[model samples]
Target: MPGKLTITRKISYDTFVQVMEKKGAPDSLAENIIAQRKYTLSKLDRRFVKELLFGSLRWYAKLYWILQKTSNRDLDKVTAQIKTALILGSYQIFYMSKVPDRSAVNESVEYIRYAGQANAVKFVNGILRTISRRAEYFPKPDKNKHPSQYLALQYAHPKWLVDRWSKRFNFERLKIILNANNQQAPNTIRVNSQKVPAHDLLNFKQSILREDKNTVYNKSLATCLVLKDSPNLEIGSQFAEGKYTIQDGSSQLVGHLVQPKEGEYIIDACVGPGGKSGHIVELSKGKAKVTAVDFSLAQINKAKTNLLRLGHDKIEFVCQDFLDFTPTQKPDKILLDAPCSGLGVLRKHPEGKWLKSPRIVHNMARRQQALLKHSLQILKDGGEIIYSVCSFEEEETIKQKEWLEREYKDAVSFPELSTRLPENYKYLLTKENILLILPGNKYSMDGFGAFIIRKNESVSNCRQAK
Candidate 1:
C-alpha cells in the first residue's frame, strides 16, 4: 500500500527532482523540463513554478541569508530535497498571490513525504505556514546600505556578477543587461540566401509558415529575423525545401562581416554544427568555394548532413583542426569564429551566465589569440580575416582587438565597418571603428564583438622579401 501510494503521489515531484539532478538546480531548467513533460500544468501554474524556481535561484544567497537568520541550524546541513521544497514553497507564499497559502503548505508537506521523509512533513508544513503568516515581518535589507545585495535579490543574479558589472558598466546599462538576460530570448532565423531570397521568403506567407501570425515580418534584411516564438518551422514545407536556417540575430551579423563575394574562396576556421558555415555558402550564392573545417569528426558529419539536406554540393567540409589542416589551394579570405566564454549571448543561453567564470574568459582569450595568429598565416596576400567572438568581455573582445593592433601593427588594416552598417547601428562603431554589438541596442543584434581586418599588402610583400 505504501509503495502504491508513493508511486501515485510522487510522480510529478520525482520528475522535478530528476530534472534538477540532470540539469542542475537552475530554475530555468526545472521550468523547461516540467513544461515539456506535458504534466497537466495550467498556464498560471506553470508561470508560478517558473517564478519560484528562477526567483529563488536568482536570489538564492539572500534567501539562504534569510533562512539562516530564522533557523538555529546551518542551512547547508539541511537535506537537498527539503531545501528545494522550502525554496519552492517559500517562493510561492512570498511571491505568488494566486497560489493559496494552504496549497503551498500542503503540497510541500506531500513533496517531503514523497521524498521518503514523512517525519519532516510536519516541520515543512509548520515552517511554510509560519512564513506565510509572518511574511511581512521578514527582515528586509536597505538597498542604500547594500546596493549589490539589493540588485542580487531583486534581479536574481549572483553578487559577484552584479559587482563585476557595477565596475565594468554604468549602473543603468548593467541593469538593462541583467534584465535582458533574465528574459526569454526571441527565436530568430536566417534566410538561406543561396536557396531563398529574403524578400521572396517574407512575401510568401501562410499560417503554418508563420512563426507568429500577429507579428509583422520584415523582408529587406538578408541577415536575420526575430520571431515571436520558436515555431514548428521544421515541419513546414518551406523549411523542408531549405528556405531558411535558424540562427541568432547576432550570429547572422558574422556572415555579413565576412562579406564573402560570389566567386571568392573562403575558409571558415572552427566551423562546427555548421550554422554559420552553411550561412556563408548561402550568402556567397553557391559561387564561393568554401572549406569548412572543425576539430571534431562528429561535427563534420553533422555539417555534411545539413549540407546534404539543403542540397548543397559546393561546400567542402574537412574533419580536421584548422591548426593542422593543409589546404591544396590558398583561400582568398578566412573567417576565424573563435571559441570563447559565451558572455555576449547570455540572453539566449541563460544557463551560460552561471556556467562561465572570469578565468574561463582569460583561458579562452589565450586560445583565441593562438587561433587568430594561425589564421593570419593561412590567409592569402591582401586577404581579409574577420575575428569574432560571442562575448562582450574585454579580455576576449576589446583586449584581443588591441593585441591584434599591437602585434600586427601596419601588417593589418581595420576596416571602417560603420560605412556598411545598417543605418540603425552606425553608432556602435568603436574609436578605431570596429563593430561591437550589445543586446537591447537599436539593431536588436545579439551582443557581439567583431573585427574585420584586412591583411596589409606590404606585409604580404615583406613575406615575398624573405
Candidate 2:
C-alpha cells in the first residue's frame, strides 16, 4: 500500500500569508508562527521562515513601490495572495542576497499558480525578472528633490514616520536615531538584590560586563549585565532560584529613582507584570511593604506568578485601576510607570513605528495626565512619586511634566535627584531637574524619561491636620 503519489509536503506559503494577515502586527505574527512551529520544525527551517516573514513585512512599502513601478499596475487592485507572493519574492531578491534570483522568482510563480492565479503567474514572473535585470532603474526621488523619499528608502521606514521625525529632530541626528531603531536590542537583566547581591551576579560566569562607556546600563546600577543577545535567562536554574529578573536597563533604573528603603511602605501604581515591583522588593531586602496595583486582571495574574517565582511574598498584588483604586494605607513612596505609546522603545519594537499614529500619542497623553493626578492623591506627605514612561514623545514626557507643575503647583516639587545619578549623567537632567533619556544619546540608554516628584511636607501636614 504505497502512499498515493504524495507530491507536496512542506509547510504551505498560504499558511504563512494567512498568519500575517490575521496578526496584522509583524513582530507578533513572527513570534506566533515561531511558537507554533517550535516543536515541529528544524532550527534551520525556522530561521528561514523567520527571515521570509520579517523581511517581507520590513520592506513591504519599498517592495510594493517597486512592484507598482515594474508592473505598471495599481497595487491597490492586486489580490491579497498575489500581493503577498510578490512581496515575499521581491524581499528575497532585494534583501536576501544569498537566495538565488531564479529560485525566488520560480517559487513565487509556483505559489501564485497554486492559489489558482495561473494567468497572473506570467505577470509575476515577468515583473520579477525585469526587476532582477534592472534593479537600479526603479524610480527613486533624489535626496535634494524629495527628502522624505530619500529617508524612506534609505532607512526602510514609512514615509510618514520619516517626515514626522525630520521635523522633530535635526536631519543628521534623525539618521542616527533611525539606524539605532533598526538594530537588535541587547538583553538587560536586573539582579534581585534581596536574594542575591548584585556584585555576586556580575561575578557569575554566564555574563560579561558591557565595557561600552556610553551605556547607562554600565553606569547606573551597582551591577548591570547586558547579554550579547536575547536568551532564555528565565528557564535557567539560577533564575528559578530567584537570582535575578530579566528587565531592560532603563526600566530597572526606575526602581532606583523611587529609592525605597528598608521597612518603608511603597505603592507601585500600574504595576502590571511586576518587573519594577519585584526589583523594588528585592532592593528593599523584603522589608518594604509594597502594594502592587494594576487595572488589568490578566497582567495582575502574570505579576502574581512573577512575584511568587522571585520568592517575594511580602508584597501585595491588587487588581484595581489606579485611576479609581484607593489605598488602605498611605504610601511612603509611589511609582507610576504610566501607560505610554512607547515611541522611545522603537529599537525594541520596530513594528510599533507602523502600527501607531499621532492621534494615539495625543490620546495617551490625556490618560497619563489623569493617572498622575490620581497617583498624587494617595502619596503620604513627604513621599516621593517616580513618574516614568518608556517613550520619547514630548507630549508624553515633557508635556506631562509641565501639566504636573501647573496643576499641582506648590504641592508637588521636582526633586534634584540628578546629584544621585552617576557623574556622566548630569547632563541629562533639565533645568527643572527632570530626567530625559533620549534614544541615541551619549548614554545609549533605552529611551526613558522619569521625573521624581516629592509631595510637599507642609501640604501633607495641612491635609492630615484637617
Candidate 3:
C-alpha cells in the first residue's frame, strides 16, 4: 500500500526548502521573512505559495506517516520533488479545506512535470487522488493503543514534544495548544506612534484595514493592529514612511516590561531585524540609547536597515557574539531575548516542529546559560535584565530561570510581573508568577515567556515598584 515515488530531475518547494535549510544559518526567521518580501509574486500567489510551503512543513510528520503507509517505501527513498509534491498535495487535500481537491491533485501532477519529472506525473497523481479519497483513514493513530503516538501523528508534532507536553498539560489543553499552532496566525503589526498612531492609519483611504480588538491585550502597547485580510497594498504608503513595522503583539509586551526611561541606556542581545530594539526606542520617546548586538553580521545589517527606516540613526550596532563581545559601557538595563527551540511561536513558524529536536533544546539551554552569565557581567549593578525566549520548553524557560536563580542566589531574583500585566491577562503568569504566555491564550496571541530580574535590588523594593 506504499505510495510509489518516481525519481525526477526537477526541484520543488524551492523556496520552502531554502528557508527551512537555513534553520541555524546566518539569517534568522525574521531575516528570511524580509527576504521573502523581495519575491515578485502577486499578493494572492504569494499567500497561496507561502501557505503551502509553511503548511506542508508544519504537517510534515503526519504527512510522512501517511506516505510511508501509502508508498510502502521509506520516505527518504523517494525523489525530492515527488516527496515535496506529495506533501504539498496532501496538505491541501487534508488541511486546506479552502482549496478544491481536484485542483490540488491536478496542480501537483502538473508541478511534477514542471519539476522535470515527467515520468512521475502518474505516481504523484495516483497517490494524491488515492489520499483524497481515504483521507479520514490516515492520521488515525488509536488513542487507546498509543496515546502519545496518537497525539503525535494526529497533531503533526514530533512524538517527543507531544510526550513532554502531554505530561505538562492536561489532555484538553494540549489539544488546544496543538490545534492553535496549526491555525494561521493573523497578520499583525505595531504602528509607530513616534511617527503615527494606529488610530490615524485607520480608514486612511489607502487600503482596507480593521483593528482586531484581540490583537493586543495591553492598552499601553499603543501601536498594534491586525490585518483583517491579505490585500494588495503599497508598501510605500505606510511602511516606507516609517509609520509602522511588522511585529507580533506578543513581542511588543517585552518593551512594556522594559519600561525604558527617557535617556536610559539599554542593550538588546540577539537583536535581529531590530523589532524589539526599535520598540524600546519608541517606548523611550526616542530618548533612550539602545545598543543592539547580534552574532550574525547579516542580521546586524538587516536590523540596521529596519532601525534606519524607523528614523533611528544613532543606536549602536555591534556584530559580535554576546558571549565574546565586551560592552564599552555598562547598560542601565538589558533585554536578553535569548533564542531557544522556538516552541512558543510554532504557530508563526510551524516548520520549527519538523526541524527541531530535544538535543537542540538541551544545547540551546546550555548556550543561553553562558549568554546570561556574560550579560549579567556587563549589566550595571541595580540594573534590570528582562530574560526572555519565544518558547515554553522547560529546558529553555523555567529551568533556565531556576538555573539563574540558583547560580546567582545572592545576586539575582525575579520581579513580580502580575502588576505589570492587565487584570484580564494576569492569568498568563505561572504558579511561580513568571510570565509564560501560552498559544491561543485569551488574546489569541503567539506563545512567549519572559521574566524580569533586577540585580542588586531587594525583593521588597521590586515588589513595591511593581
Q: For each candidate, what is the lDDT?
A: 0.68, 0.72, 0.75
Count backbone overlaps in model 2.
Answer: 0
Worst 10 residues of 2 by lDDT: 1-10
| lDDT, candidate 3, 1-466, per-residue tens | 2223221101225544455555532124433554655534455555666667777877888887887788755768767777877887888898879988887787777767766888888788888888989854644867878888888888799888888888889878988999889888876777777876556654432433322222222233457666565422356555666777788777888888888998899999899889999999888889999999999998999999888988888799889888888888888999999988788888777777877777888988888888777777778888988988888777887888787777677578687887666566677789876788888676777888888877884433332210
lDDT of 2 by residue, 107-127 (tens): 878777777777898788888
Higher-scoring candidate on TM-score, 1 or 3: 3
Which of the predicted structures, 2 or 3, would earn the higher TM-score when compared with the native?
A: 3
* TM-score per candidate, chains pooled: 0.79, 0.82, 0.86
Those runs of model 1 whose alpha carbons end farther than 4 Å from true positions after fitting are 1-73, 86-134, 137-141, 207-223, 233-241, 305-309, 457-466
lDDT leaderboard ranking: 3, 2, 1
Top model number, TM-score: 3
Best by lDDT: 3
Report residue 453 deviation for candidate 1 (angstroms): 1.8
**lDDT at 257, model 2:** 79
